[model samples]
Target: MAGTGPQVARSPLELLNNQAAAEPPLLVKHAGPVIFSVVGFIAAAGANWATRRPLLSGVHRYVLIVGGSMAAGIYVEKKRAEHLATRDAMFRHYIELHPEDFPPYERKQFKDLFQEWIPIR
Candidate 1:
């Protein structure tokens, strides 16, 4: 004999864990920020030491500003790439699940538009 029971709803933690398992990890996610932060700090510290002044003074200020800007740009680009990848994956899955919703012409158009982000299969 076997017992039968209704399915139980997943808790928030379980859902999060499942989602994390399903999604592909982005290498740039943590690498970009950590690398940028370390580089910026080192540059600032070196500039301050060489000039014997605070980071806000002279060349040190410029170095810190440039490093910060570069870091921000890298982070933004990485996030954008991740977002685009996720969107493209969802779009492909949706197309597979509901082929009727997308006509051949429209599918081709979408594929062409995202050719850079998504590889044609």
Candidate 2:
């Protein structure tokens, strides 16, 4: 919504009240892990309070925040990678089985005008 179109940017009133596209910044694997870390932080805080281990004030808190964020992000990334690999393999198999259906791919006549037109630049 913030960076959608020029109309929003052009309006002085809307521009003044616009919020950033990304909240909490893009520090850890985009903004996804940040949300996961928040949930983990809450759970860890509750556990820490209940146990009363008598450790440093916030040492465990900070550690859990980072560790939880990484754990969630890595798990999700791994799952996505596996799904993509499976889908790619299926497509390759289909292409091999029906080569006649898919004709030879021809290169576009003018791939990009800038490369040929603007040789000096």
Full-model lDDT, candidate 1: 0.61
lDDT of 1 at 97: 75
lDDT at 114 for candidate 1? Answer: 65
Please, what is the TM-score per model? 0.40, 0.44
lDDT tens per residue, model 1, 1-121: 3545432323322322233443446764456665666676677768777878875567656666567856786877778879977876776676667767654432235666664666679
Q: Which of the numbered candidates is closest to the native, going by highest lDDT?
A: 2
Candidate 2 backbone clash number: 0
lDDT of each: 0.61, 0.62
Error of 2 at 36 (Å): 5.3
Q: Which residue pairs collide, candidate 2?
A: none
In candidate 1, position 100 carries an lDDT of 75
User: Which window of 10 residues has the lowest lDDT sum in candidate 2?
Assistant: 7-16
Tens-place lDDT per residue, model 2, 2-38, is: 7566433322222334353344545644545666667
State in Å the error of residue 28, model 2. Answer: 10
